[model samples]
Target: MEPKNNEEEWGKTAWEFLTQVRTQSPLIQCITNFVSMDLMANTLLSAGASPAMLHSLPEIPHFTPRADALLINLGTLSPSWLPSFNSAAELCHSLGTPWVLDPVAVSASPFRFNACLELLRFKPAVIRGNASEIIALSMPQHSTTDSTKGADSTHESTDAVEAAKLLAQRTGAIVAVTGATDIVTDGNQVVGARNGVALMQKITATGCSVTALIAAFVAVDKSHALDATVSALAVFGVAGELGMKEAKGPASLRMHLIDALYGLDEAALKSHVNITSLC
Candidate 1:
């Protein structure tokens, strides 16, 4: 395999991906939790993509097929919602539309754990989650007895690199574990991005919002999924970094982050993107 070690080469494409989203205005259908609707929609809108917060089974036949990409976030997972998630995944897989999975607190319960594994069979274009979520998700066969603290990560992002790689291999999807330094991998290759400010972590649904960002990025370039996933993280980080410059706290950071994302120019993307090959 060719080496992806050149940092500048990896970093430059961030603008291309951002530009494509602005030009294409891909429609991203998000089947996310209640808490994330507002932030996630704003995140996609700021990145110049349309966000559709639709998750009803009735609309799957008509709506999901037409979406440029789909995002299935298992944040507020329940038995009633499983059918909708499954129907959308099956539709997206059949149509070859890039879809992303955000398995929030995936191992928090046995029910949610099994649901994630079932969705993996549909082959999402990307799977984005935190270290604890990735680590728990990587073990597909193990029982859902793993004690993962709900929503928050007990482990650092670096600690889940191996697990992320293994999950990518198993699922045939780009695996991204977000933390201080976001990690992206496609089983054989790994990329790292360091740009977001620390304060962004304190905000609610930031992870969920970034997952939608990943979906939007991949939606624009379904063929180059690895690059798209990395670009999304780096771009989001750059926005957080810029937003932090004027942010007073997580609340202000959240607001400024959307503003930064909406206003990102090529210069900002070029100067702030920090993606590099980890291997």
Candidate 2:
């Protein structure tokens, strides 16, 4: 086995895996919020994946079976969407379909907290969140530093590594914590993804869209769920880094970011990714 101390070796496979997802054009079903729908849909399409927004309870079970992978984002959850979300999760569970969970603002309210807890019962293949969100989900006693109330992170990714690992162990899922430096773990091993721009947080819906991207990869590659999760995060991060150089602000960065994702290639990822320590 290679040394985990070396940061050079860890992100290699992850970068390659993401390139494949963009080239394969997998179908990913997203049960995300309205605030992120436009950006998330465009992001998925830009990454060469088909996107489907499925929210109605009457149609979710039918749609879940047809989807390659399912992404559930609790960003703007509503009472009406609850039944559909639960039904879709159950269908995905029963059908052996891989799914990702984005506990957006999980630390903000009792409704979200309970919803995430219930979703955990279905056993998501991957769980992605920011530092405060991850810490809240995995270690409820930990104090939250994020100031956006229901939308952002004030803490760095490194701060949530332990919580992410704990959550991964408890759920038997891959946990991805994003911030200045992204960290992904699967209970025993941790992979740090060093390929994003700080300006990404300045834009809205970047995290929610990346969650969908992970679902796209998981659709085709379930055996290496952690790899898929890390790959998607790294790929998205790298695109953001590139997009920032040409962006004027958050709005411009969002469009440029999508273009960068559409233009992403293996060569670009190889040259730009700064990740290390893959165990």
Top lDDT prediction, candidate number:
1
Clashes of each: 0, 2
| Model 2 per-residue lDDT tens digits across residues 92-200 | 8999999999999887877778888888889899999999889889855423453536668767789888888889999999999988777888888888777878778
Residue-by-residue lDDT tens digits, candidate 1, 1-279: 244566666667888889999999999999999999999999999999999999999999999988999999999898999999999999999999999999999888888889999999899999999999999999855455666788989889999999999999999999999999999999988888998988888999999999999999999889999989888999999999999999999999999999999999988778777877878
Error of 2 at 154 (Å): 3.5
Name the candidate that leads on TM-score: 1
User: What are the root-mean-square deviations of the candidates from the true structure over C-alphas?
Assistant: 1.4, 2.6
Assess every candidate by TM-score.
Answer: 0.97, 0.91
lDDT, residue 193, model 2? 79
- Give me the displacement of residue 160 in model 2, in angstroms: 1.3
Error of 2 at 248 (Å): 1.6
Clashing pairs in 2: 7-276, 7-277
